[model samples]
Target: MGNTDIFLDKYKQLENCAINEFKLPPDGSAVAKLEKRSEFKDIKYELNYCREVRNLLQHNQKLDDEFPVEPSNKMIELLDTVIDRIKNPVRCIDVAILDRNLIWRSYEDRVLPTIKLMNEKNISHIPILKDRRVVGDFSDNCVFPFLLGDDNCHIDENTRFKDLKQYLDLEAHPSEVFKFIPADSKLSYAEKLYEEARNRHERIGLVFLTANGRSDERILGILTAWLIIGQ
Candidate 1:
């Protein structure tokens, strides 16, 4: 019934937060499992410290001289951060951070200087759309590789996106290299999709955020690997 109680209560709150975030039962194992999640990786060590303190306090009848009777300011901050993160995950568009800088390619527009733009701006992927709705992605990987292949397909600024389709193999097609996620989705969901793509040996060059994670939804933003992996 003192500072130790307050600290213990704080840790208990964090456990509950993790439970809700993971949709698991309120138990030590659930919180432990959440500690290993990528979204929570930034806070893993901090959560570890809080867990240790909570464990010591719960198992002891009295405060030990070895432990700080009152949780430090840093500990309190850690608790607050973990709770906030678990309760409110940062959305895909929020982390995309390049919302204003998003480059676009209209499916009907003639082929662009994709490599030149990518080099000048250091961009890895650009979203291609059909009348404001995301249709697919255009990445430097597909561009350079296609150019290296047979030159039978005449590609120039006058070339249209549909024209380039014939030159690109199915594996290297722009349409096959992107995924859609709702703007409101947690970045974690996007990460899982990327992992799934990797398991299938397909590279997801871009993750386009839209109204409802649909290809036909108006493009709201685009997420590159750099942004998704944390930037």
Candidate 2:
């Protein structure tokens, strides 16, 4: 068909995809519903423009048996992108730092070397695992208690993470908390978690992606505030 026909076809596909993806009422305004979702924030303006174009093509009278406006290639591409995004949303693991590339330590691992590495790499948190499962996390906050507890207690070459077991526990440090999300969780869900944490005046240091969002599950990847918010 012509450009107008092609554009209308694609736009209708987009509307159907949005309706099915979001479970919206079939008779409702699909574009308007999509605008309200945080996942569609990036393309809100484009959606609005496309909606206006659709209105013009459907409501305005045509002259000489031709529509006044036709969608460009770029518009068609944008519609394709939005439809694809709605069909297959970006998952948390898709953007997380995968486990193989993560800098982590075991409970029996030396703490001094890890601390030096953290300093060199500017790493704020490191998962403390045992048998490939996260037992706790180590961070600057985990070391503060030791420093302030007793003048004699200090970190040394032979110090192991096991020595700071109490401090490394998930609930031991309240300043920064760790959360576990399923590996297949959508990025929007992760964002919502961070937003809720912010609303509660809490800080989420790391979001570990696991099979079923449980600490007992194997860690597949990790998410940080900078990684999620910066995106």
Candidate 3:
């Protein structure tokens, strides 16, 4: 996971370079200089993965949504191959999650304004808090039916919508709300959770909550499958 961060940083930097600067010949001296500065070898797996996807797409090959390759293996092999020649240690690569400045809302508040925020952020999910504790989540699945009147028309500016609080109850669906925990958690456990979600074909969002179940547990940072694969 450590190399994943370095890989992503290098990938993004190279992406910016490619977009903003003119391309040099793949084997030219200037290309060597560019490679030296950015250290593309640290992110070879990601590049190869992208190349594979591009090849598949360009050739009209059908690629499944599923990921068949193993992430931990690819990262390890890449690091081992370049260990002596590289300046950095591959084992030092770390996983840092993206932050979602969560907006806490009471179930009593009108749904329109809350749903509006969800739409504006382009996030499929939002956490609902009651008395400082997470009570439930407000997501596309939860909001859509109500908006379309297929479930119930409980969304007006003046309507007090606590009646639908059952949808957000924590006990209702514990797995739907991902609790961020320590990275030290066994890779097998993490992989199991990810695999179960993938097999079931659900959108996976797991938060790597910082250590200790303290005040920080209220919110940490978000993790997605693509982010884990160092994409």
Model 3 residue 171 CA deviation in Å: 5.3
lDDT by candidate, in order shown:
0.71, 0.89, 0.49
Ranking by lDDT: 2, 1, 3
Candidate number achieving the greatest TM-score relative to the actual structure: 2
Residue 207 shift from truth in candidate 2, angstroms: 0.7
Best by lDDT: 2
Q: Estimate each model's TM-score.
A: 0.83, 0.93, 0.45
Which lDDT tens digits does candidate 2 get at residues 78-97?
Answer: 88899899889999999999
Error of model 1, residue 94, in angstroms: 0.4
RMSD of each: 3.3, 1.6, 16.0
Candidate 3 per-residue C-alpha lDDT over 1-231 given as tens digits, one digit per residue, 9 for 90 to 100: 454444434433444454334355443233234343333545555556644433343345334843333234454454344432233322211343433454556778777777787778776665666555455666655555445555556567875447556655543443453644554443334445666776876545444444442424544444545545562
lDDT per residue for candidate 1 within 147-176, as digits (tens), equals: 777767446767777665543332457445
Model 3: residue 27 alpha-carbon error in angstroms: 37
Candidate 2 TM-score, true structure as reference:
0.93
